[model samples]
Target: MNEIELTIEQSKIYNGVICPYCKGISEMIKSKEIYGKDYGWLYICKPCDAYVGCHKNSKRPLGRLANKNLRKLKNEAHRYFDKIWKLKILDRTKAYNWLSEQLNIPFDYTHIGMFSEKTCRTVVEISKRALNDNRRLDMDFGVEPVTEFFETI
Candidate 1:
């Protein structure tokens, strides 16, 4: 019907993946194209300017290309999720495993980097709830809260 729909149909027929916003095939290019400094390569949808960084030392994309809004959501999700392990309530692997269980996805596929915007929002919500629950439990059980203890140099 629309130009975007037509492109999406064509993209599906091809081997390459389509951009979520513009329905265009993404291109792999150096990050310098966008950032003016070579951070690394990225899979990018040029028209939409949506992009995902590659894995270290490889061209493989870290996740689906994300626009500004999705990127913001992903950052928010990470901020909340990181606290679970940062507080030492759980180790990194265990924290991801816990998130996997909560999200009802396979542990191997449960990375926040690969999450959709809706899933990212879910992560933020769930992590906040878990943090609150942990605080309540700590209060009830008289457990001391763990926080950074700084000593004067």
Candidate 2:
């Protein structure tokens, strides 16, 4: 495990955040509450918690997708969203192709004869994660985090 220590000076100096869990630079996150709260804000782990405010770091690397690859995936997702706005079952072909290109994970899309349903579900979840990551990228690029957008969603 990487020894992640909070730089108190840095934390105090800036109004930003450091994760209480791993002490990594915390990224602001939003969560949808079911009861009365409905939605709220929090700081979270950048690498692991794509959007759900999950802090536990996974072995998986963040944005392992190249900037170019991520852009392509994001654009394709927008197109997919245009075709079908439902968040549940996104198109498998687009999702797999983009993920394969982004992660450089060699996969035979056509040869995926057996686990089609499982693959579609997995890709849908990954697509949501990728979309969340895209928002973070927008933030990094100086696009404002629209709190209203989070509240309404």
Best by lDDT: 1
Q: Please report, as a residue range, the 10-residue window in candidate 2 with the lowest summed lDDT.
A: 59-68
Tens digit of lDDT per residue, candidate 2, span 1-153? 223343674332122244333445655544433223434554345564422222244322222111223334444444433232233333657655665654444544222211223443444455555656655766888976422122111
lDDT values, one for every candidate: 0.75, 0.39
TM-score against truth, every candidate: 0.76, 0.27
Query: Model 1, poorest ten-residue lDDT window?
Result: 1-10
lDDT of 1 by residue, 17-103 (tens): 557678778887888988899978888787887888877887766666788888899999998889999988789999998998899
Misplaced by over 4 Å in model 2 are: 1-97, 101-115, 144-153
TM-score of 1: 0.76
Clashes of 2: 0
